[model samples]
Target chain A: MDNSQLFFDFAPIWQARTLLLEGFGIAMFSAVAGIFFAILLGLIVALMRLSRYRALRAIAFTYTQLFRGVPLYVLVLWIYFGLVYAVGIDIPRIPSGIIALALLNSGYLSETFRSGILAVEKGQREAGEALGLRPWQVSRFIVLPQAGRIVVPPTGNQFVDAIKDSAILSIIGVPELMKVAQEQANMYYRPFEFYTVAGLLYLIAVIIVSKGISKLEQRLARFSRASKEASSGERRPSEVGG
Target chain B: MSETLLQLRNVGKRFGDHVVLKDINLDIAKGEVVCVIGPSGSGKSTLLRCINFIAPPEEGEVIFEGRTWKRFHSAFNFIANRKYEAKLPTLRAEIGMVFQHFNVFPHMTAIENVVLGLTKVRGNTRNVAREIAERSLRQVGLGDKLDQYPEKLSGGQKQRVAIARALALNPKVMLFDEVTSALDPELVTGILDEMRRLASDGMTMVVVTHEMNFAFQVATRIVFMDAGRIVTIGTPEEIRNTTEPRARAFLSSILG
Candidate 1:
């Protein structure tokens, strides 16, 4: 109960290290799973929003709005309790939590993707078409590749957010990093040290991811410059009118 | 008379409340070079875009290679026209276009830009596409730039790569929409010279240009347009001899 005891006791944390690692492992697993699904769903929704079909675009837009408008916490509860309990489905809590997080993350990520694709100049698409590529072929080869260059940084940022957001799954008793900290804090009566350590671990993970994304951005930049240099010889044909 | 390769009938375009072009009728023959000269916003570029189905005309039928007339209707809800969609791949293959901004794939090498159409659209093997790409680059006098990317190239070189990209497709008709308008003054002649060589080789070309000197030197027929309509269509000699007030004014302003 004394301030000195709370501040100086490394003993409680050392004793509970294994439990913390277990929670960290679970959080990391779910974050990675959530990101993979988020990327897949985001890509599909992004393409749907860009589709020529009115109904398809409308449906994609509705889905993005519905998810993005709701809070992540509410979404997790809905997927875990509302949908599962209402339907009497007996799916495990951890899997349900991951599905919920991924679904929610996808809505925001889809907007990122849609804007990225739109950011590519219309002329790039025309250039693709002038080369005789089919519409789908243009999207796949030229549009998507250029759009990826613009989307990666933001998508990476979202992944970092998802890693921290994984802690929300603890509310459903999924035993993620935050859940472990709570359990350790309660058992050893060391709320301040345990939670602080948990926070520091999350910070470290985000820093590593940030550095990796920056490296990736630099590599893409270099590739773009090199490609430009290699193709630098031809003169433009004269314009028809000026 | 030369065999007509492309024709437009009753072509019209409207963007919201603004009319861009109206009731345009024209014919282009095989291996002919037609130049369309007009002030900005006169629908010259839009007309070229309509031919390639880039900006589908609001009302018109386009006939290419003596084929059935194909109509373009604006789809209010779609990204592109769905009804008149068939044969787009084939039609586009036969028609190559270059834009004012060059619009080269910044991520691709010069040869990659040229070879992409050959390999992806024409189904040529990589080796064969590379050979053809190199040949096309050489034709544009950029044989040494096969490995360079667009950003590394000067404005003139980037536009040439764009030209070579179109040429590699071996399009039956080429459309140039102010291709050199984005270039520095000193670089304009280099691009113009390459285009002249292509014209001499009998490539069917339609150029929308501001450079009256180049048009006079290269175009077999020059069409002057204003207010979204053609004012006159004639050979350079005929245009040079015209006494029409508007034509005289336009010519004098440019010449001065």
Candidate 2:
């Protein structure tokens, strides 16, 4: 319980620094990959949901509903471990983990994307229509640019969630941050010390991401302010997700 | 120039069961500025909207360029409002609509906003589009402010940019929906002045406005509307000196 003993107990961490660093890299890699793919997938799904075609909307609704309803942890486990057992195919843990995270995040983000599209002022659409632009052209040029300004902040927060969610993949031997921390702690019988380091790493990662989001938001503010000048400043849809 | 360029016959619109416009009819001749004026709930704006197919009439035909746009029945109407998405781009190009709140594209500079539809929808090359955009901006007296964004521009400037954007399309009939209604008192005249110039330039226009003075001064024809129906249609002088109670009652309320 003494201070010297606590210091001695954590001495092994310096030796495991390389393992921890590599683990952090893997965690970040997974988060980035998941977010990148999810954003693309979510965008397509959202457009489908907003399509005039009833069948496309129904399909997008069903997909988002199915993936969002499933717990992320279960999804990670099923994709990584259940594939070999149930589907007779072995997916390497990293790719499998990213797939699960991307699918889950895309499901959630599709709704966020739709909300962003809807949040755009109706005048943008009318202006496009009045200007002789087709509906598709209207969405692409007029509505999407304005909606992009509103969607970036929430989409960024989703990236932070992806980073945290990446930890669950450690259970399936993904060699991410949590997995490395647990392995080091088990080897030295020092769970508290190693786990604390993992938690601090996550906090630092989240802080970095949040700061990046603020800067991106400021950059986009100039554009949003211009588009919204003529309309009444009401109903900000920026906070679509945590 | 006196030939009729656009005609609205028995135009009507409804949102579910609540009828907003009913059996409205109007003819807009080339080189004429037809101003529709009425109270807030009056269908002056709705008539302009129906003409542009912004609010497609449930029953009627809009005859423009000597070709009738069948607005209601899909079987006979060559272009029903919602059904003619294919033809809308062409139809809309011929008729420009300026909203009450100038819906300028915020991301683009004033010149770019004016150039966008010309380049994208009209398929004009960048050089040609820029030339048209510059000329249009100059026409609206925004030549010096072409690089400014909507937020940087005053209310009057934004409306002018909107007008320039619409003008770049070379629309046959420009539909203005209370273009100056959202401006400050001082800013209103700048937009009205722009309108006056456009009318003088021989542009056929259908304007829905609350500005009584501008309507009286500039409208070749004034259509007084109430509760979605045209109460009276005549020259500005006729409207000003009308004895019709419906017209007089509404004018007294607004002109007061």
Candidate 3:
């Protein structure tokens, strides 16, 4: 074949744009859902690891080890296929994909959260406790808020990873971005063109989300600087002194 | 002394085998300012911490307002520890503490830092907490910085917010753990003056400090500790004229 015959064509990509967009939507849904659950699950596991009880710490330790040691691909397959055969309960494709992503990411995120919580000064916790706060109240009100600030940048990276990892769900026929690309490529006999569009779609989503995270981090920092000055201003004299 | 407000009887603490406090027996009477002074490794901070149960006594008891906690709850004894955990908040509520680092919540504005204890622990409404926080911040001369985060404040200002955080709770006794140590030399007097005002208001307090002049002027009594034990304790005048060799040496070193 001549070099011209092998050149990239833009027509196939334009024709499949709608299908590609739908697939992109499904892929993002799984990632967002997975990230939401991962965040909550990660916090619980992190707390358990930091718990005073030996049993709790051990359990949390084992959970992080088991999940982190397994590849995301294997985890997705186990939930989608192994669970059905072994437990006689078949989880639907999308939910199964979400569960796998959540489980895998929670293991990494729990470690991230644990480090963030530990990064808070011990004095902060003591200050809270000194004010007669219950242990959980101290953690909830003081430690976690400070830890949340410390963990934001790292957690944003995890969100990006979740978006990329969502592609692994294609093997289970979840009709996510990768699966749609595969089907479109075969139907149109233009693998390179369809695949390129899917890659670009993922890249666009990631860039937008990362930009959003950066904005969020800036907002948090700004809020910490001057927030709630107005609420207490009711009692203050009109002069705002530095 | 009028009615003992806090008592530590044979209180002891250790990190592994290295003792931080040993057989510490002290009594803080109502409306008295007791200042603990000592060398760097002498356990003055740990002694103050014991009063608030920040560093729970490994042996003996801490009695506050007639209620007592004998050592901290153990993790091995889950059921009993749970009960102890429930009781601790009430016991600790009566005592307030400030740290050397001025550990104001970096994420919170000064008012929010002060309001947290009131709303969360005392169950005060937001309005009530705000009123109390404002009063406390103003008392510490931080009225202008009420909206500022700890990171935006100076060391002295952060310490003021920390003081306000503790004061807003209306604790029966306040513990100051080297509260002015982290301040710039010029800013030290402001914090000391704020503390002096608190002393004049008859707030029961236990202060661990390195500032001899402040200790001499404000403390109703001075405790000199060395090697995890109280070497001597007396009124400021008596401590100045202390005859005990260990206490005398420490005093001379600080004066120089």
Question: Which candidate achieves the best lDDT against the true structure?
Answer: 3
Q: Write the per-residue lDDT of candidate 3 for residues B71-98, one digit (tens) a residue.
A: 4446577776567667888888888888
Q: How high is the CA lDDT of each candidate model?
A: 0.85, 0.86, 0.86
Can you give the lDDT of residue B167 in candidate 2?
87
| Candidate scoring better on lDDT of 2 and 3 | 3
Among incorrect, acceptable, medium and high, the docking class of model 1 is acceptable
Instruction: Give candidate 2 misplaced runs (Cα > 4 Å).
Output: A1-8, A83-85, A227-229, A233-242, B71-83
* lDDT tens per residue, model 1, B96-203: 899888888887889999988999999999999999999999988898889997767888998999999999888899999888888899999999998898899999
Question: Backbone collision count in every prediction?
Answer: 24, 0, 0
Q: What is the interface RMSD of candidate 3, in Å?
A: 10.9
Let me know the TM-score candidate 2 reaches against the reference structure: 0.92
> What interface RMSD do all candidates show, one decimal each?
5.1, 8.4, 10.9
lDDT, candidate 3, A36-114, per-residue tens: 9999999999999999889999999999998999999999999999999999889999999999999999999999999
Candidate 3 TM-score versus the reference: 0.93
lDDT of 2 at A143: 88
**Over all chains combined, what TM-score does candidate 1 have?**
0.92
Please tell me how candidate 3 rates in CAPRI terms. acceptable
lDDT of 2 by residue, B50-98 (tens): 7877767888878997878765555565444356657867888888888
lDDT score, candidate 2, position B247? 90
Positional deviation of A29 in candidate 2, in angstroms? 1.1
